[model samples]
Target: MDPAPSLPPSYEEPAYRVFLDSLDYLPPTDVERIKSAFAFSAKAHAHQKRMSGEPYITHPLAVAGAVVEWRMDADAVCAALLHDTMEDTGATKQELAEKFGKPVAELVDGLSKLDKMEFASYQEAQAENFRKMLMAMARDLRVVLIKLADRQHNVQTMSAMRVDKRVRIARETLEIYAPIALRLGLNKLYRDLQDTSFRLIHPHRAEVLSKALKAARGNRAELLGRIQDGICDKLAHAGLKADVFGREKSLYSIFRKMKDKHLSFSQVLDIYGFRVVVDNVPTCYLALGALHALYKPVPGKFKDYIAIPKANGYQSLHTTLIGPYGTPVEVQIRTREMHNVAQEGVAAHWLYKDDGESSADLQIKTHKWLQSLLEMQSSDSAEFFENVKIDLFPDEVYVFTPKGKILAMPSGATAVDFAYAVHTDVGNHCSAARINHELAPLRTELKNGDLVEIVTSPKATPNPVWLSYVKTGRARSKIRHFLRTTQNEESARLGERLLRQELLSLGVVPISIPGEAWDALVKAGGQQSLEEVYTDIGLGKRLPSVVARRLLAREDIQADKAQHMTLAIHGNEGMAIQLARCCQPIPGDPIIGSIRKGSGMVIHTHDCPSIRKSRSSEPQKWIDVEWEPEDGKLFDLRIRIEVKNTRGVLAQVSGAIAEAGSNIEHVSMDADPERLFTLLRFTIQVANRTHLAAVMRGLRHIPEVTRITRERGGEA
Candidate 1:
C-alpha cells in the first residue's frame, strides 16, 4: 500500500495520507467513508492542540493508520478517526451515526472514556473507566483494537506530558494494555506497548539495558547471520523451501527475563532468534529436522507446539540449538498461517480477512476471554482487578481429563481449580480427585499431562479452605458465592431458632404475620421486613432479644402465650454453626450454644472450661440446647491417652482406636522424660457416645494404656 495521491506533500496531509493508503485493501466506498470521518475529526479538533504542540487531529490519524495496518474492518478505521470527537469536541454520537453509520458510532462510543464523570478517587475513576472500556470491548472487540492504537500513539508521544503523568500512563500501558494485547495474540502490539511503557517508566534502566543489548547485538551480529544462513541452506538442501528471518528480542522482554531470573545482562542468552515460515504443518517439522541437522539441538530445549497449540492458538516448533562458536541460538518453525496468528493474534483473522479455520478458531478463543470479563463484572472492583492481573500471564500447563480430552490451565493450578475449569457443578460437589487414577488431595498441584478425574458426591459441597489454593477466578468466585449463601441460610435458621426459644421463655409466641405487630416491629428495627430482621440476627449483626422486644412491644400482653418451635439439628451444619474447637464437643456430650458475633452459634460441651468462663462474662449470650440423634453423622473428638514409656505403646493405642471403628484424623505426642508415661493427644472422628465408649473400652484393655480421658478446652 502507498500513500494516497489525493493529498499534497504538506506537513498535515502526510498523516492522513498514510491512513488513506493503508485503506487500499478496503473497497472504494469504505475508503471514502474513512476519509470523510478523518475530515470530520480534523474539523472538530481544528482549534485543539496536543501537549506536543502538534494539531490534535494528528493523534487520531496516527491511530487510524495503525488500525489499518492491523487490517481492521472499514468500520474500525472510521471509528479510529472519530473516537475522540464525542469525548473532546461538541459532536454527538447520534450525529456521528447519521454521518457515518450506527456501527461506526457504536465503535466510537465504546472507545470514548468517562472523563466527564465524577468518582471517589483517581484510582476509582481509572478502574471505572477501564471497566467501561472493557465492557465496550467485550461487546465489540474493535473497541480494544482502536484503544490499543490510541495508547500506542500516546505512549510514542508521551515525552510531551509531565513526568508523573508519563509514568502513570506508562504503568497503565504495561500492567493493563500490554497484557491484553498479549492475551489477544497481538504480539506486534504487545511488544511495542511493553517497550514503550518500559522506556517511559524507567528511562535510566531502559537506557542502560538498551546499551547492553546494542553491544550484545553487535558482537553476535555475525553469529546470527551465520545461524540463519546455515538453517536456510540446510532446508534448501533438504528440498524444503521456507522463508527464514531473524527477530531481535524486545528490551522489556529481556529486562523481564533478567529480573524474574535474577540474572545480569551478560547471562541473558538467546538475545535474538530466527523464524522459519513454511506453507503447511508438515513442513514445520521438516524445517525443525533440518535445523537440528545444521546444529546440535540443546537438550530439553525443543518444544513441539504444533501438536498442542497454545491457549492463544499459537502453533510452532521451537528449538534452541548450539550455533557456531557454541552460541545458543533459539529458532522457531511454523507454517505461514501459524506465523500470522502468532504475530497478529486475533487481529490476524481480520488482517487475513478470512472466515476459514484460522480466523474462526482465533475468534472463538478471543470471545471466551471477552466473556470472562462479563463474568468478572459482578465482582467488586478490587477483586475484579486482581483477577484481571491473574489472567494476564501467558504461561500455561496442558492437563488431560480422564477421557483424554486436554485442558489448558495456568501454571500452579490445583486439582480444585481443574474441577471448576471442567464445570462449576463439578467443583461445587467435588469431594476428592484421582490424579492419574491415584487418589489425590483436592489441593494437589496439577502437573502437565496429568490425567485428572474428579470424584464428586451428592452430599459433598465446597469447602472454604479450597479458596486458599485455587488459581482461577471462576473457582474462587464460585466458592465464595457458595460459602456466602450457605452462611446466610445457616445464620438465618439459627437466628430464627434462638428468637423463638427466647420468646417462648418470655411467654410470647411470635407469629410470622401479625399485621400491626409486624409493621411496628419493622419500624422499630429499621428493617424492611421480618426476614431482614431474622437475617440480621443470623449474621450476628443484631440480637434476637432486641428484635423480639420490638415485636412484643407492638402487641398487648397476654398470659399463657408460650410456644416451642422445633429447630432442625443436622450434624456438621456447614459453616452456619460450628462445634467449638476449644471444647471439641460431640453429639453425645451435654452441650450448650453460645451466640458468636458474625459466626452464628458455637456449640460447647457443658463441662468445658471455656464455656464456664464464658458463663461468668457473657451469661446472657448462652442458651440451653439439646442434641437430636441422626444416624451416620461424624463428630470430632479429642482424647488424651497416657501410655507407659514403651516403644510399641503408640502402635497399640492406634490399633485399639481402629478396632473400635474410629478414624484418627490427627495425632500429637508429648514425652515427659521425668515421668514413666507419655501423653498423646489424638483427634478422632466418631458417631456418638456409644462409639467413643467402645474406643475407650478397647484402649483400656491394652495394658500399656494406663489412663485415657476425653480432652475438653485444652485439658482432659
Candidate 2:
C-alpha cells in the first residue's frame, strides 16, 4: 500500500482525519462540503506561513475541524475556512459570496478589521477589533467558536517563539481570548488556553508547581482508581445504567483555586474527580445515591445542578466523597442529555436535535443578554469595546427574581445589576431590594437562587454612588448614561458657584457677570449645541479666570487691589515676595502664606501639581518672579546631576555652570546606577534670570548627564 502514499505530514491532519472519518455522524454531502472548503483554504493560504513554521492553512483547518466536532452547519464550516482570507489575502467579499455563498462571505467580512485609517489610538484600535469580532459573533455565533479555536491553537504553540513575543501572546490570550471563550461557555477550550498561556506567562512558577501536581497525581493514583471503580460498581449494583469517567483538574483551574481561596497546593483536595452519566434524570439521582452509599460523602460539598442548571446549561449532581485511605474525592452524576448539554453547551441541540420546545430558539432567547451587546451600540469604539469586555466577563452567581425566574449575574454583582439586567426602567427606578425575605441594601451581594425583589417608585432615579457599588456593566453604564443626561443641572449650579467665587476674589458683584454674556461665551466655545455649556461647566472646563477675564472690561465689574505675588531676596523691592523655587503655582492649585522676606508673600501652589499631576499642562508656572535685591543672602536649593564620570567630572560640571552663567557655591555626588556611575551635582549661583537659564542649558549639554530635575528640601 506504499504506507498510505506518504502523506504530507500536515500538523492538523492526524487529529482532523479522525473527525473527517466520522461520516456516519454527518451527512455525506455536508462532510464533502467541509473537505472542499478546507481544500480551498489550503490553496488560498498555500504560500502563506505563520510566525511558526506551519502552513497558515493549518490554522483555519484546525478551526473548522473544531467547529465540525461541535457539529455546526455547513455555513459555519465555510465561514471558518474564509475567516481570515478577506483580511490577509486581498480576497474580496464578492468573490467569497460567489464562490462559498452569502452567509460565508458575511461572516468573513464581519470578522475582518476596520481599515487602519479609522483608528486614532490603540484603545480605538482594540475597540474596533472587538466591534468586528462582536458583529461576527452576533451574526453567526460560530464565528466566535472558530475564533476561539484559532486562539487556542496559537496559545498551544506559543512556546515556539521568542521570549518577549511569547509573553505578549500569552497576555493577549489571558486578557481577551480566554475570557471570551469562557463567556461563550466553551469550558474545555477556555481552560486549555488559560493554562497554556499561564505556563508561558509565568514559566518558572508553572514548572515548580506543575512538578508538585505530577507528584501528587502519582501518589494518589491508587486512591483515585479505586474511587472510580467503586462508583461504577455501586451504580451497576443499584441497576443504574451509566458510564463513569475520571480526569484531573487543569493547572489553570488549580492555580485560580489557590489564588482565590488562599489555599496551598496540598489544600486543594477536589483536584481529581470522576463523572457518571446515566440514561435519564431519575437514573442520575439513582447513581448519585449509589455513589453516596459506596463511600461516605463530604459535608457541605454537594450541588444539585439538575434542578437548576449552571448559567452555561451544565446540569449535574456534584458530591465530594471521602474515599479509601481518607483521600478526598469528588463525583459528578448527570443524565446522558444533561451530559451532552454540559459538554457541548448551546450547540448540542443543533447537533443532536434535542426534543424540546424549539431548543435553538430557546438557546437564542437565553443568550439574548449576550446578543444585546450588539444592539446597545456606542459611537466611540473604545467605550463599546470596554462594555463588551465587562459584559463577557465569566464567573457568575445565579439568583431568582421574586417571580421565581433565574437571573444569571456576574460574580460580585449586586441587586442593582440584577434589576438592570431584568429591565432598564426597573433598574433606573430601583429603590430597594429584598434578599431571602429580608430587606437588603441595593449593594447587597446576591447568592445562588435568592429571591430578590426590586422596589421602584415614580420619583426614583439612579444615584452617583450606585456607580461605586454596581458590579455589572449594564448597571454601571446605565447609571453613567443617566448622570450624563442630568449634567445640564450640574452645569448651572457649578457655573454659578465658580462665577461667584471669581467675583469675590475680584471684589466685584456676581450679578455683573451677566447671564446673557455667559450664554454668548458658551456659544463661542464649540461645545455640543448650547446647554452643554453648563455640562462643560460642571465637568470643570469653564475656568473662573477665563470667565473673569471675559467679564473684566464690563462697566459694572470692579477690579480688586491684589499683589503681583512676586518673590525675591527677603526684603527687596516693593516689599514683594518671590514665588518659592521649591514649588510652582498653577491656576487650579491652591495659593498660600504671604512672606515679607526674600520676596513678599511668595506665591506657591497650595497642593503641588508636580507630584499630583504631570507638569505637561502647567508651562506658565515656569515663572519670571525674581529675588528682590538681596536683603538676605541666597538660600541654597539642592540640584541633582545624572551623568558619566571619568575623573575631572566634578571640575567639569562646576566649570560648565560658571562658564554659561552662574556661580557654584558647593558640589555633591550621590550613588547612582552603580557606585561608579557618573553624576555630579553643584549648587550654582543664578543671582537672577539671565544667569539661571544659562547655567541650566550648560549643564544640559554636558555629555554624561541623563536627567536633571529640581529636588525639594524640608521647608516650603
Candidate 3:
C-alpha cells in the first residue's frame, strides 16, 4: 500500500527492486525470475543514462512498476524489466531468448522498435508499427497493454527530456495510443493519456481549454448541485436503494464536445450530469421515469440501453431533463453492473470471467472480435492497424431485427456493414432491406430501436459502390475484397478480349493458328501453352500489346492488335467520375466527381451542403456525370440532417426517403435533446446519381431541418 518502499540503497536494478516489492500478487519464484531479468537488462543497458542522470535500468524498472499497478502477471513483469534490452541495448533476440525464456524474449522483441528496418517514409514506419501491433494484439493483447503501460510511464517523465522530444512523443501518444486505449476499452488510461498528451503537445490550447471548462462549470455549479440533490431526493422518495454520484465531463471529453459539435464551452449542455446506480436493471428504468417526472423531460434525449446493450456491453438509461434552473442537464440511470460496464468496458468482462463456466460463455459471446483479428491477420500490419483504428471508436448504435434480434454496430455503420456483419454470404447476396417494414438500401444507416430486416437473394452480389457508403472497416474491407475479386473477373474478361484482338492483328484467327505455331509461341514466351499465356495476361502481369508484337515478329499474330486493344478510345481525357462514399450520390444526395485521368473514377457528394455552406458558390471543377448503366446502377449516398429527436423520428425520416423511392443504406446520429439538436448522417441509394439531389431537397422539406449536407470535395 505504501508503494513497496522505493529501491533499496543497495539496489543495483533499482527500478525492479522497487517493483518486486510493490505488486500485490506474485509468487517467490516469479519474483526472483523478474529480478534476474532486471539485472540482465541493467547489464545490457549499462552505457545508458536518463535525463535525470539515473542509470537506464531505472526506466525499465519504472515501466515494470507501472505494470505492477495494473496487476499484470509474472511474465509481463519480467518482460517489462527487459522491454528495452533488445531495442536500445543491442541485445540480440537470440541472446535474450537464451537468457530469459522464449516468451519473455518474444515480449521484449514485440516491444522493440523497427528502427533498423528501412521504410519509404516516416509515415510508413509509423504505419508498420501500428500494423505490427494489430498482429500482436490479435495474438496476445497483453503485448500492447504492456507497451501502453511503458509509454504511460515514459510520458510521465518526458518533461525532463528535450522539448522537441516531449512534443513528438506526446503527439504520437495523442494520435495513436490514446485512440488505441479507447478502442481497447481502457477508458481510464485512455482519458488520462489524452489529457497528458494534450498538455504537452498543445499546452496553450490545453490551458485555455481547461480554463474555459472550469469557468463554464463554475457557472453551472449551483444548478448541477441542485440537480444532483433532486435525483437523490427522487430516489429516496421512490424508496429505491441507489447511489447517485455527480460526474462532470472530463477535460478531454469537454474539449471533444466543443470541437465536435461546434459549440462554445458555455453552450454545451449535458456537461454537468449525474449517474444513479441502482441494484438491478428494472430499477434503472424506474429511476429514469422518476427523474422525468421530477424535471420536464427533454424530448428525444432518452436512450434505453438496458434492453439494447452497446457493442461493448454498456447498458444504461440516459435522459436529459429541464431542471429547476431552466437548464437541461443529463441523468444516466443504470444498475451498478451497468455502471461498471460503462466505465471499464471489456475489462468488465474479467468480473464475469472469474466464474469458470461464465468465463467460458463470456469469452464465447464477447470475444468474437478477438477471434476476428486472427482472421484479419491475412492483411498486412498497416492495413490491420487501420482496421483496429476503425474498430476501436467507442460510439455505437443498436438496432433490432423484425424477429426481435438485436445487432450492435459502430455508430456510422451502414446497412452494407450490417450485411457483412450478419454473414459474408448475406452481405454478398444482399438485394434489399426493410427497416421496421419498408425497403431500404444496403447502405442504410440504422438508428437505435429500428426494426431492420435485411432481404437477400442468390442473384445479387456485394456492390462495389457500397465501399463508398459503408462506414465500418469490416464492411469496407469485405466490400473491398469482393470488389477485388470482381476486378479480377473483369480483368480476365478484358484479357481474353485483348488476346483475340492480338491474334486478329496478326491476321491469324485462334482456330487458324496451327498447333506448331502456337506451341512455338508458348515456348518463346516461356510459358507452358496458350492457356498459361492467356492466364498471365488475365492476371495483369503480361502485356497484351507486347505479346501481340512478339507474335507479329514471329508470325504468331499480326501488328493490327495494337489498334484493337486501343485503351485511348476516349479522346478528351476527362477526370472520370468515381463516387465518394461519405455520402453516396444516390438519387437522394448531391454528387460530384473530379477526373483524375488514368484513374477510372473519383466521386464526391453533390454540392456537399457542408462545402456549399463553407463556400459561397460551387467551385468551377465540379464536373457532372451520371450513372452509366443502361438500367438502374446502385449509387451510394450520404445525407446529413439536423433533426428534432422524437418518437419515431428515425422511422419518419426513413419513411420520407422511402417515399421518394430510394433505399436507405446507412444512418448515424449524434444527438442531445437538451440542445434541441441531433446530427443524422445517412447513406441511401436511388437509380443513379440524379436521385441524391432530390433526396437533399426532400430532407430540407422535412420540418426538423437545422441543416442538411453531403460530403463533397473543395470545401474540406
Candidate 4:
C-alpha cells in the first residue's frame, strides 16, 4: 500500500486521521488518487471559512468521510472532497478532469448547485437546482450520494446560521433530503437527517420529546428486558440461530406518528421493537414462527414483505404481538443479507462487496426510479419538483397485471394510475377497468394483489375528471401535459378560423395574405411564430379584430367599411370554447360570446343578466355568436322544483326525470320539517331546450310538486 500523503499544516489532525482511516479498505492506487484529489481541493478552498469559523476544507473532508463510510467508489469519494470547489472557488471542471479524470470531474460538477443562475423566486431557484441535480443523478447515482453527504454535513454544522436561514435549511432537509434518503434505503442517514432537522426546526418540541423518551425508556427497561429474553429463548428452542437486537422509535418518528394518526403520546403503542437477523430466507420465516409462538399475534398486523419486497428493495417479515402485560410488541425478521439491504439500501451493493441477487434487485429498483425522473424531465422545474416530492414519500401497495406481472404502486393509487404505470398510451386511451375480473370505474382505488386489467379504446381520450382522483405523480403530470397540448392545438385552430373570418369581412382573401404579412403580425405580438400569435388570439389574450386591423394597416382598404361577422358555435370545439355555467345555454338558446383571457370564449344566453352586465362594462369583449345544429351532445341546466315535504318525493321526482330521458347530474334540497313545502334543485343533462321542457312537464305531473322553473343568472 502507498504511504499516506502529507497534509497541509493548517489541517485539523484528528478529523484528517479519521477520514484517512476510512479509506484503508480501498486499493493502494485508489487511495493514492483520492489523496491527490484531497490535496487539490484543500488548495482550492484553503482560504475559505464556514459560518462556524472552521476551515472550509473541513466540510469537504467530512463529506468525503461519509462517502467512505457508505463504501462508495474512490471516484465518489474524490468528488465529495471537491464538491464545493467549482461552486465556491476558482477551480474549474477542466482542471479537476485533468487532475482526477473525467468521472470524478462529472461527479463534482453534479454535486455543485446552480447558484449563479437568476430565477424569479427563491422557490423557483431551489426547484431548478433540484432538477439539475436529479438529471445528473439519473446519469450517475454517485452524484446524489455525494450531494446527500454534503447536505448531511451542512445540516449537522448549521448551529451558527441565522434563525430564519436555519429554519429554511432545516425545512428543506426534512421535506426533500430526508425523504430522498429513506427512498434510497439509507436508513441511518435518513433518520439522522430527519432528527437533526426536527431539532433545528422545533428545538423545544425536540427537547421535550427527548426527555420523555428517556423517561419512558427507563420505565420500560425491565419489561423490555423480559420480552427480549423470552424472544431469544423461543428462537433458541426452535433451533434457529439468530441475533436479536432491541430498537426504539426516534423522537421525530414518534412525533410524526402521533400527529398524523391524531394519537396522544400515551396512546402510542409499538414504540419499542425488535429485529431478528437469521441465516437465510427460510430461517427468516422460521424465526417468525417461533416469535409468534412466544406471544399472541395481533390480527391484521402480520406482513410478509419477504414474499413481496418494497419499492426500494426492502424485504422482511413484520408482526405485532400482544406481549406480557397486554402490551403490543413489534418484531421484524429477516436474513443477514436482507438486514444489510434494509439498512444500507443501494449502498449495500458496495458495502457488502457482493454482486449477488439482492444487489441486482436493488439496482433494478433504483434504475426504475431514476427512469421515472427522466420521464418527468419535460415538465417545468416547479412542477417536476412537486411530482418528485410526491414520489419520494410513497407508502406502497402491490398490485398485479392481468398477465401476472407484479407492480408496486403508492397507497390509494387508482386504476388510472395503474394504467399509466403500464404505459402512457394505455392511460391516455383508458376508458374503463376490470378489477379482479369485474367492471369498475377508472377512479376505483386498487387494493393489494388486485388483478387490474385496463380497457382502452382508440376513440376514448383522457378526461379532465381523472385529475381529481389520480394518485401517482406520473399519471397527474401525463394528464396535465395532454390537456395543455390538446388545448393549445385547439386554440391555434380556433384562432385561425377567427382571423380568417375577420380578414374576409375586411374584403381580403384569407389565403392571399403573404407570409411576410404573417411574419410582421408575429413580430408585433412579440411571439416566436405566427402560430403562437394565433394561439394567443384564440386564447383571448389578443383580440382577433386588433390583429386583423394591424394586418390591413399597409393596405388602402377602408377599415370603417368592415362588416361584423358572427362566429358559429359548435359544442364539440373542445377546450377552445366553453359554455358559461351562469346561463347554461343549450343549442336552441339565443347566445352571445364573451372573450375571457386565457380561457378562450365563453358562450352565454343572450338574455343572461351576467352577460348584460359584462357587455356594458367591457363592450369590446362581446361578440355576436349563434349556436349551430345540435350534434346529440347533452347540456346541463339547473331546475328548481317546489314540492311538498313528504317521504319518497325526491325519488319520485328523480324517477320522473329519468322517465323523460334526461339524466340528473346533481341534486340538492332545502327543506324544513315544520313546513309543508320544500325546494329541490336539480342539475340535469338533456339534449336541448325541448328535452329540458319535456323533463319539466313530467316533473309537474308529480302530485307533490307545486311548481317548476329553470334556474339562471347565477350558480344554483
Candidate 5:
C-alpha cells in the first residue's frame, strides 16, 4: 500500500557515507548486499519524504546505522535498510523476496506491519501491529533488534512530526521498545532509548534531572578522580593488570532511581561508578580484593555475579565502597569477556568474537524466551500485548531446584512460578511445595538461594487461583489455558445434563430433534449448532429452560404429557449451578436463582440484599429455583458473636459449636486490645437453616457470649 507523497531531500550523502563507514566489521559481500537493499528501498521511496522533510530513505539509512552499531547480522542490516519498504512504498513482500533473497525478505516481513488490514479502532490497530512485530521477533531475535533500532531513530527525529503524534510514539517507545532492550540485556540501547523517550515524553522532568546530574558530576569531579586513581594504584600494587574506567550512571537511570525510591536527586547514590576489566577470572577476583582493601566495602552491598550469573547471562563482581569524602562509589569487577557480556548482553557473542562460549548458547536462551512468547500467543491482541510485557521486566531472583540447579525467575515470583519454570508437566500436576525444605504455600514469594521442592500428585491439576499470584507470564497463561479447557469440558457436560433435565421436566420426552429443526433452532439463536446451544446453556450464556421452550414450541409434543413443574435441585450440580456464598442457602431456605453470564445458576436466599440489588436491573435473570427433600448435603453458615474479652472465650465458643453438631470450618476475630469485648466470626457447616439456628442458640447459652447473630446477604 502506497502512502502519501514524500517531500524532496535537501542533503544526505555525508550521513549515508558515515552509515557505510560503521559497517567496517561486515564482509565485503555483506556490505554490498546492504547497499543493494538500500538502493532498492531508496528507489521505492524516491519521491517520498519523512516528516523531517528529508528524503524518507534517510530514516531507513539511519536505522541501518543503529543496527550496524548494534553489530547485528548482515541480513539485519539489509532488513533495517528496507524495513519501511513493504509498509510504505507499495513494495510487495514477494518482490522483496526475489531481490533480497528469503532471509532478508523474511526479516523485512517481520519488521513490516499490516497497515492495509483495517481495524475498528486505533488501539486495535496498534495492538495488532504490536502482536505481529513480537511474533516476528520471536521467530528471529534480529527482527526486534532491527525494530528497536528503527524505533530509536524515529524517536530521535520525532520532533518533526505533529506534537500529539510525537508524544504518542515516544510513549510507545518508552513503554514497549525500551523494556525489550533491557530484557535482551542491551544496556547501551536500553539506556539510549530510555533517555530519548524520557526527553520527549517528560521533557520538564528530563531537563530537571539533566541539570541536577550535570551539577552533581561537576561537584564530585575531584573526589571521583581521587577514588579512580586510588583504585588504579591499589590494583597495580596488587600485581593485577586491569583497566579502570569511570562510568557515570545515565540520566534516565538516575531519574528512575529517584522516582522509584521517592528520593530527591541528591539522595540517589551510585550515580558515578567504576568498572574494572581484567584479563582473567582470577585477576577479576584479585582486582575486587584490591578495591575492597583500598576503600571500606559496604556490608550486604556485594553481589558475586561471577559465581551466579544473572538470567541474561551477565557476570561480574559488584561491590559498593565508601569513596573519598564519605561518598558511596560502586565498583564492578569482571574479566574482559565478562565486561563485553555485561555491556552488550546476549549480543556480545555476535558483537565481539568470543573464544570459548559461542553464540549458540546465547541463541538457545533467546530461543527459549521467544518460544514462550509463541506459546502464549493469543487471538486477543490486548491480552497478547499484556502477557508479553510481563516478561520484559529485567529484575530477577535466583532460586534453586530440589537438585542443585539454579533457576532465575522474575522478582515477586511465587513458588508456583518455579514449578512451571521447571517443567509444564510439573506445574500442571503440582499439589504442594517445600521451600528450603519446609512446607510453604504455593503463593509464597520465592527468595534468592532458596531450595524449592514441588510435590505433585497424579490427580493434581492447575488451579485458576494460581493465576492471581504467579509472576511469570508463562505460568499465568498456562493456568488460564488449562482452566479454559477444563471449563469448556465441564460446561459442555453440565449443559447437556441441564438441557435433558429441563426437557424431561417439560414432558417433551424427545431424545433428539430432527436435523433440519435443530439447525433452524440454532440459526435462530445465532449459534453454530445444537451442541453450542447446549454448551451455552450449561455455561449460563443462555438459559436451558429458555432454549427448551424455544425448541419444544416448534416440535410436536403431546399436550397431555406436558407438565408444569419446577425442576428439583439437589445441590450437587457441580459448576452448572452453585449455592451463593453470600447467603449460603440450603435446601430449607426460600431460594431464588440468578443466571449469571458464563457462570450458570447461582442460588441466593430470596431476601439476599445482593439479589435485590441485581433484580431491578436484570429482572429476566431471575429464575424460579427450589430444593429437593432428603438430599443430605453440607452448607456453610456464617455467624458473628460478641463475647467478653476473657480467657477461654474462643475455646468455649468452639465447644458450644461442636456440641450443637455443627463444624466450624473457619474463624476470624476482630478484637480490640483494650476493650471489654471481642467479636468472632465463624463459617460453620450445617445441614440446613434449622441446624444453623441450633448452633446460634448453643452459642447464646454461654455467659461470655453477649451478642450472637446469623449473617446473611453477604454480611460477616
Candidate 6:
C-alpha cells in the first residue's frame, strides 16, 4: 500500500512515462508490478517492429495506456502490457506466470492469437482465435477488456498496412469490435471505434458526410445554443440543478441514419441534441417534465428507459420536442452516476470507487452475458462466432415476465427468444406463449412493456423452424445444439440398425464383434470412437455395406455365404427416416429405402418414378426396406378429384373425408369460372391403403365428383 516513488529523469519514453503517471491511483506495489511487466514485454519484443515502423514495445504500452484510461486494476494493466509476448516472442506462459501472477499470465495467454496451429483457411483460423478469446473472456472479463484495447490500438495505426488488409481490419472492427463495445456499454469506445472504422472503410463517403456535418454545425450553432440555454433555464426555474450540454451525433451514426432511413441529409433532424445530467433519479424525471413544459413534446417519441433499462444496463429518459421554427430537438436525462455508467459501462466498476447498487446491477448483468458465452463454448468455431455476432445487436425491446421482472431483448425478438432468455430449459420445452394474458403462437413478436408468459410442456421440444424467426443468439444456438445432439443420437440408432441388418445378411452375428475389433475398426476409419463411425454411416457419409465389410475384415471372417434380410420401418422414426414427398408411402405400400447423404434413409413407393430413375443410377444406395404392420399410425397421401363447379362442393368434400375417418391436412382447388368442372387436390392422413380407399369411395358418392384418382410422382 506504499505510494509509488517518483520516476527517474533517465526514463524518458513518453508513452511509458504517461502510462506510469496514470497509475497514481494504484498502490506502490501494484505500480511496481506493472512496471516490471512493461520491462519484461519490452525485452521480449525488442527485436520486433510493427507495420508502422515503431518498436513493438510501444504497441503494448499504448494498449496498457488505454486500459489505464478505463481505470482497470493493476493486474489487467500488467496483462495488457504483455498481451502479445506469447504470440510473437518465444516467451512461455510458464515464464510469465513465474514472473507475474497466474491471473496475469492467463490474461496474456487469452489475448495471444493461435498462430502455431494449422487451419484449413484463414477465416477458420480467425474464428478459432475468436472462439478461444471469447471462452477466456467468459472466465475473466479483463481478457476481453485488454483485447479490445489491443484491437483499438492496432486499428488506429493501420495506415501503414496494405489497403486490402486495412479494409479487412476496418470491417472486422465495425462488425465485431464496435458492436462488442456497445454491448459492454462502453459508449465512448464504441463511438471512437465506429467512427474510425467507418472512415477507413468508406473514405469518400465519410469525407462528404464530414463536410456536410461541418456545414450543418455552423448553420445550427445558434439554434442549438438557444435550446441548451432554454433547457438549463427551465430546470433552474423548477429548482433542480443539472448539467446540460449540447450533444452532436457522431459521423458514423449520421451516415447510418441516412442509409438506414433512406433520408436526405436535410431530412435527418435531431442531428444535434441535449443531455441533462442530474443529481438523482427523481430529479431526472422532474427535469424531464420541466424540459417538456419548455417545448412541445413529440407524440410517440419518448422512451422511459429508466423504468426498463436496456440489455446493456443503459438507463435514461429520452424524448423529442418540437423546437422553435418547427425543428425537432432530442433530449436525454439521467443522473450523474448514470452518465458515468453510460459512458464507461462495465468499466465504471473501477471508474467509480463505490460498490453501490448501480455497480452491483451492472456486474450482475455483465456476468449474465458472459455466462451465455460460456454456454455456447461447445459449438463449432464458425457457428460460435456467428452466434456472438448475432448477440451484439444494439437495438432492443423490453418485455416483462409474469412476475413483473423486466427482460430486455433484441428488437424483433419473438417469444422463443424470450423463453430462452428466461432459461434454456424453458426455451427447449416451450410449446406456446401468452402475451399480455392472451394466448399466442410461439413465433409472435414481442413488444415493449408487454407481459409474456411462456407455456412449456415436458413433451415439447425445440422446432427447427424456430431458427428462422428467433432474433437472439442464445435461442438460435440452443435450438441448434439440441437438434444436433438429437440428430446424432437418432443417426447412431439408425446406423446400428443398418449395420446389424447388413451383418445378418453376411451370415455374421452382430453381438460376436469384440471391443478390440470395434476399436480397430474405428482407428482404421480415422474416427475418434465407434459412435462417430456410426454417426457417419447414419448420416450417409459412409455406406452400411462398406462399414460391415470393414468390421468383418478386422475379425478375419469371410462373407461368401449371404442371407437376405429386409430393414423394417415403423413410420415414426425421427429425423433419420423420412418419407419421400414425391410419392408418399403408407404402411401397406411396397417401399424401397434410399440412403441420401446427410439425410439418412428416404422411403419411397416401389413404383415411384423418381425411385425408378434413382435406382437405375444408384442401385447400390437402394436397400430392401418394408413397412411394419400399422399400429394406428397415420401417413400423408395426396389425391386428385375432378368435380362439378358448384357452391358447397368444397364443404361436402371435406365432410365426406371426415366421415370416412380421414383427416385432411391440406387442400387446394383449381377452377376456372367459365368451366363446368373443377380440379381439387387434397393431402389426407390415413392408416393404410385400405383407409385411403375408404376415403376415395366416400368422396365418389358426391354427385359433384366426376373422377377420383391417387396422385404420385408429383403428377395430377
lDDT of 4 by residue, 82-166 (tens): 8989998968899888888899889888888898899999999999999889889888888888888889899999999999999
Expressed as tens digits, the lDDT of each residue in 213-237 for candidate 3 is 7777787777777778888998899
Mark the 10 consecutive residues where model 3 has the least summed lDDT: 566-575
Residues 19-64 of candidate 6 have per-residue lDDT tens digits of: 7788999998898888788778877887889988987888999999
C-alpha lDDT values of all predictions: 0.83, 0.68, 0.68, 0.87, 0.81, 0.87
Cα TM-score per model: 0.89, 0.68, 0.70, 0.95, 0.91, 0.95
- Which regions of candidate 2 fall more than 4 Å away from where they truly are? 1-43, 115-120, 269-272, 354-362, 372-394, 492-525, 543-716
Per-residue lDDT tens digits of candidate 5, residues 406-458? 88889999989999888888999999999999999999999888999999999
Question: Model 3, residue 284: displacement in angstroms?
Answer: 3.6
Ranking of all predicted structures according to lDDT, beginning with the best and ending with the worst: 6, 4, 1, 5, 2, 3
* Model 1 per-residue lDDT tens digits across residues 443-523: 999887899999999989998888889888777877877887789887777778777876875666666537897788778
Give the winner by TM-score: 3 or 6: 6
The stretch of ten residues in a row with the least summed lDDT in candidate 2 is 567-576
Instruction: Kindly provide the TM-score of model 2 when superposed on the true structure, using C-alpha atoms.
Output: 0.68
State residue 660's C-alpha deviation in candidate 5, in Å. 5.1
Q: Give the TM-score of candidate 4.
A: 0.95
Best by lDDT: 6
**Candidate 5 lDDT for residue 293:** 86
**Tens digits of lDDT, candidate 2, 661-704:** 55567777776566667556666544443445566788788777
- Supply the global lDDT for candidate 3: 0.68
How many steric overlaps does candidate 4 have?
A: 0
Off by over 4 Å in 3: 1-18, 50-54, 92-100, 160-172, 214-221, 279-286, 335-341, 348-366, 373-384, 507-543, 551-716
